[model samples]
Target: MMNTYSFPLSTLGLPNLMIQTSDGKRPVNISEIVFLESARNYTFAYLTDGSRVITSKTIGIFESPFAKHGFIRINKSIIANLSYITESCKNEGYAIRLLNGQWHTCSRRRTSKVKKVIKQLKTL
Candidate 1:
């Protein structure tokens, strides 16, 4: 079973995600998360500082909450932060490179939406 934390917002007034660790629940700033990967029933949050936080919650649970924070479901197993996306690999078929140099491919069904989002991000 997973432990839950009551706090919904961080000190910065941004949403906080409670990450389950060995010690206890740790609140992480939504903006600091660069990407998320699903592993069976668990989800791994990859932060900007090269750290990873594991939570027992399914990745689907984070989709809506993270959308407002600039996260997009790039693929079935990966949700990427738009701010962390460095480049879009058009030659590689809807692949995007994150700040950590990790690449994630967008699923066929999501390709159009991903492209539109990337295009908008590039303009800003």
Candidate 2:
């Protein structure tokens, strides 16, 4: 059996990630971020409200920092918020559907890791 605990997302010590914009910087809640896509020289954080922030940080920087915040690298170019992964389908292929009605294919190399994380989340 898995050990279950009552831990909120904030208790994980995940910070309110800030992003730079042409105007200024904006504090973003983790829950608001749907995923992040790596750009040429910057990365774009896509929000639940259909907004995005382009920053100079690389995708690698985000991987270590936001790992405990329910964010996972589903692919080389994508970092998805695991908390919002509402459902998964493996009939045709492995993919996860988000609460926002978006579906992303889990990379072949990361499919098992993603599934393990999901199982751990259930026992949390």
Candidate 3:
């Protein structure tokens, strides 16, 4: 459904990249790299083509300025790319529609802040 490119790491000495299949066993090749915070010892890398959702735990507290161009910190646990946002609404709470058509909510703790940012984004 989505275009993917894969490169082998055997030659370059970089870690190999693979796509997860529906069966959860077959790892296919895909193109594109995304950085995510690791739940354990270190940060990890992943493919952007449906490989995973970026979560807050995977991101470091000190964020890169470059990430500001496309990503927004929604709360303590989530940071999402504006490009992947399909729609968003806020009233008493905040809800966002992602590119995959999935809806995610901004926790009440972060709702006001989220709305403020969304408002700013609309003007830009």
Candidate 4:
């Protein structure tokens, strides 16, 4: 069986970085995020638990913080957590497969960055 995982907000090393979800402010562990996708004016955060949360903030709103937490912005529409990526997919352009089996493609400009991040993760 796949191991179930969870982390309380207080235990996360981040200080006061909270994600505003539908219910209210939720303390999200940065590493728990599998990927993020932007749809029109909203951004959806997809987590490893297979739960998706909508955030009113734009995808760019997360760039800085996510970068500090192992997230690589692969394209204008998608940002993925390096820890959750299962493989580097070159079949269709440049893409990555998450542990949860979700695929995200990188834009031409960001492909090198994704490769660098994947290499960094392997070294760690």
On lDDT, the candidate that comes out on top is 1
The CA lDDT at 118 in model 4 is 72
Cα lDDT tens digits, model 2, 1-124, are 1122232344354568778877788898777887888986689988889878888888888897778777899888889887667777776557777656777888899999988888787777
How many clashes in each structure? 0, 0, 4, 0
Q: What's model 2's lDDT at 53?
A: 88
lDDT tens digits, residue span 7-123, model 3: 122223233334233445434222233333345433333445656533233355424542544455565545555555657765556777655555567777767766676666666
RMSD (Cα, Å) for all candidates, in order, is: 9.2, 4.6, 10.4, 5.5
lDDT of 1 by residue, 16-116 (tens): 77788867999998888989999989999999899999988899999998887778998899999887777677665778888888878899999999888
lDDT of 4 by residue, 1-124 (tens): 1222221222257444578877999876666678889887899888779998888999998888788876789999988877677767676588777778877788999999777767655665
Show where candidate 4 strays beyond 4 Å.
Answer: 1-17
In order, candidate lDDTs are 0.81, 0.77, 0.47, 0.75
| Candidate rank order under lDDT | 1, 2, 4, 3
Cα error, candidate 2, residue 74 (Å): 0.7
Highest TM-score: give the candidate number. Answer: 1
| TM-score: model 4 vs. ground truth | 0.81
Candidate 1 global lDDT = 0.81
